[model samples]
Target: MNLYPINAGNFKLDGGAMFGVVPKSLWQRTNPADANNMIDIAARCLLIEYGNRLILIDTGMGDKQSDKFFGYYYLWGNDTIDKSLKKYGFHRHDITDVFMTHLHFDHCGGSIQWNKDRTGYEPAFKNARFWSNKDHWKWATQPNKREKASFLKENILPMEESGQLNFTGLPELDVLKNSALGFDIFFANGHTDKQMIPMINYNGKTICFMADLLPTAGHLPIPFVMGYDTRPLLTLDEKEKFLQMAVNNNYYLFLEHDAHNEIITVKNTEKGVRLQEVFNCNEVFNLI
Candidate 1:
C-alpha cells in the first residue's frame, strides 16, 4: 500500500477559534496570527493506494463556493486536488473510495462540484464510493444550527444523488468489526458526533489520520482543543486518551490540517506528550 499527501490548498481561520481558550501568547508561538488574528491552515487530504482501491480520505474545500463565501476564509496556495493527484500518476476518476472523516465543508466540499451546464451540482469523483458513518450522515443531512454552515447541501447530497454514497457500518460500537481495511475506528464526539479516526496498520507501524482531533503538531497538548469543537471539556479528555495511546504505541500522526507539518510522532515527556519528530510524506512512504 502507498499513501500520498494530497494538498488541496490553504485557507485562513481565526487562530482563537483554532486553539480554543488557549491564550494567543501560547499558540501564536507556533501558529503566528495575522493582523486580523487569522492563522493559515492547509486543507491536506490523504490518498491511500491499496490493491484495487484508491481511497481519498477527504476532499479539501472545493472551488464551487461563491467568491463572496470564499472571501471569509481567504483561500490561497497553488496546490490543488487534481494537481496533487497527478503528481502520483492518478486522477479523480482513479479514486475508488472517498473516506470522509466527517461532513464539514472544508473536509468534504471537494467531494462534489458544479456541473458544466451550471444547472446543478454533482459528485467530483465520478467513480468513487463516498463513505461516511450512518449516524454522521444523518446528522449532516439534518444539520444542527451551530453546524449548518459547515455542512453545506451542495457539498454533500450530490454523492447520494449520484448513487455513490455508502455507509461504513451500523453506527454502533462494533462498526469496525468486519472492516476490510486493517484499521480500527476511534470514535470521538467532542469535535462532532462520531468523528471516525482511522488507526491504520501498514508495514510494521501504525499511522493514524488525526483529522480534527489533533489538527497540527501544535495541538499535541491536551488542552489545545479547537474552540470550534462543540464540547471543549470532552475534547480535552479525548485528546488525553488518544495522545497517550499514540505515544505508547509510537504511532505516526498524519495531520490533516497543518499547513507545514506532514507527519509527526510524539514522546511521553515530563511535560506530557511532546512532538518527537516531523517527517515529509515521502520519508514515511519509505518507512512503510
Candidate 2:
C-alpha cells in the first residue's frame, strides 16, 4: 500500500473561529493572522493506493461556487485535485472509493462538479463509490440551521443522484466493522454527528486522519476546539480520549487542514498531550 498527501488548495478563515475561545495571544503564535485576521488553511486530502483500489480520503472545495460565494472564503493557490493526482500519475477516474470524513463543503465539495452543459451537477469521480455513514447522510441532507451553510446541496446530492453513494454500516461503539478500505474508523460526534476518522495501519504504524478533530498541531491542547464544532463541551471530552489514545499508541496524525504541517505525533507531557514531531507524508512513511 502507498499513501500520498494530495494538496487541493489553500484558503483563508477567521483565526478566531478556527481557534474557538482560545485567546488570539496563544493561537496566533502557531497560526499568525493576516491584517483581516484570516488564517491560512489547506484543503489537504489523502490518497491511498492499494491493489485495485485507489481511495481518496476527502476532496477539497471544488471550483463550482460563484466568485461572490468563494470570495468569502478567500480561496488561493494553484494547487488542485487534478494537479495533485497528476503529480502521482493518477486521475480522478482511477479512484475506486471516495471516503468522505464528513459532508462539510471544504471536505466533500470536490465530490461533484458542474456538468459539461452547466445545466446540472454530476459526480466528480465518475468511477468511485462515494462513502458516508447513514446518520451523517441524513444529518447533512436535513442540515440543522447552524450547519446548513457548511453542508451545501450541490457538493453532496449529486453523488447519490449518480448512484455511487454507499453507507458504511453503523458501527458498534464507533468502531467500523468489516470495512473494505482496510482501516478502522472511529466515529466522532463532537465536531459533527457520525464524523468518521480513519485509523490506517501502514508499515507498522497507525496513522490517524485528523479531520477537524485536531485540525493542526496547535489544537493539541484539550480546550482548543473550533467554534465550528456543534458541541464544544463534547469536543473537549472526545479530544481528551483521543489524544490519550494517540499518545499511548504513538499514532501519527495526518492533518487535513494544517497548511504548513503535514503530519504530527504527540507525546504525553506535563501540560498534556503536546506535539512531538512534524514530518511530511513521505518523510514519516518512507522511513518506516
Candidate 3:
C-alpha cells in the first residue's frame, strides 16, 4: 500500500474561531495571524493506493463557489487536487473512494463540481464512492442553525444525486477492523455528530488521520479545542482519550488543516500531550 499527501489548497480562517476561547497570545505563537486576524489553513487530503482501490480522504473546498462566497474564507495558493494528483501521476478518475471525515465545506466541498453545461452539479470524482457515516450524513444534511453555514448543499447533495454516495454503516462506538478499505474507522462526536477518523495501518505504522479531532500540532493541548466544535467539553474528553492512546501506541498523526506542518506525533509531557516531531508526508512515509 502507498499513501500520498494531496494538497487541495490553502485558505484563511479567523484565528479566534480556530482557537476558540484560547487567548490569541497563546495560539498566535504557533499559527500567526495576518493583519486581518485570519490564520493560514490547508485543505490537505490523503490518498491511499492499495490493490485496485485508490481512496481519497477529504476533498477540500472546491472552486465552485462564487467570488463573494469565497471571499469570506480568503482562499489562497495554487495547489489543487488536480495538480497534487498529477504530481503522483494520477487523476480524479483514479480515485475509487472518497472518505470524508466530515461534511464541512473545507473538508468535503471538492466532492462535486459544476457540470460541463453549467446546468447542474456532478460528482467530481466520477469513479469514486463518496464515504460518510450515516450519523454525519444526517447531521450535515439536516444541519442545525449554528452549523448550517459550514455544511453547504453544493458540496454534498450531488454525490447522492449521482448515485455514488455510500455509508460506512459503523455505529459511533464501533471500530471497523480490517475493512475492505484496509483501515479501522473511529468516530468522534464532539467536533460534529459522528465525525469519522480513519486509523490506517501502513508499513508497520499506525497513521491516524487527525481530521478536526486534532487540526494541528498546536491543538495537542486538550484545552485548545476549536470553537466550532458543538460540544467543547466532549471534545476535551475525546482529545484526552485519543491523545493518551496515540502517545502510548506512537501513532503518526496526519494533520488535515495545518498549513505548514504536515504530520506530527505527540508525547505525554508534564503539561499534557505536546508535539514531539513534525515531518512532511513523504519524509515520514517515503512515498517519493
Cα-based lDDT for every prediction: 0.88, 0.92, 0.91
Clashes in candidate 2: how many? Answer: 0
- What order do candidates take by lDDT, descending? 2, 3, 1
Task: Name the candidate, 1 or 3, with the larger lDDT value.
Answer: 3
After TM-score superposition, what is the CA distance of residue 149 in candidate 2 from its true location, in Å? 0.4
Estimated TM-score for each candidate: 0.96, 0.98, 0.98
Expressed as tens digits, the lDDT of each residue in 114-195 for candidate 2 is 9999999999999999999999999999999999999999999989989999988778785785487888898889999999
| Model 3 TM-score on a 0 to 1 scale | 0.98
TM-score head-to-head 1 vs 2, winner = 2
- Model 3: lDDT of residue 160: 90
Better of 1 and 2 by lDDT: 2
Q: Cα lDDT for residue 44, model 1?
A: 88
lDDT of 1 by residue, 34-66 (tens): 998999899989887888899899999999999
Show model 1 residue runs off by greater than 4 Å.
170-178
The deviation in Å at residue 171 for candidate 3 is 3.7
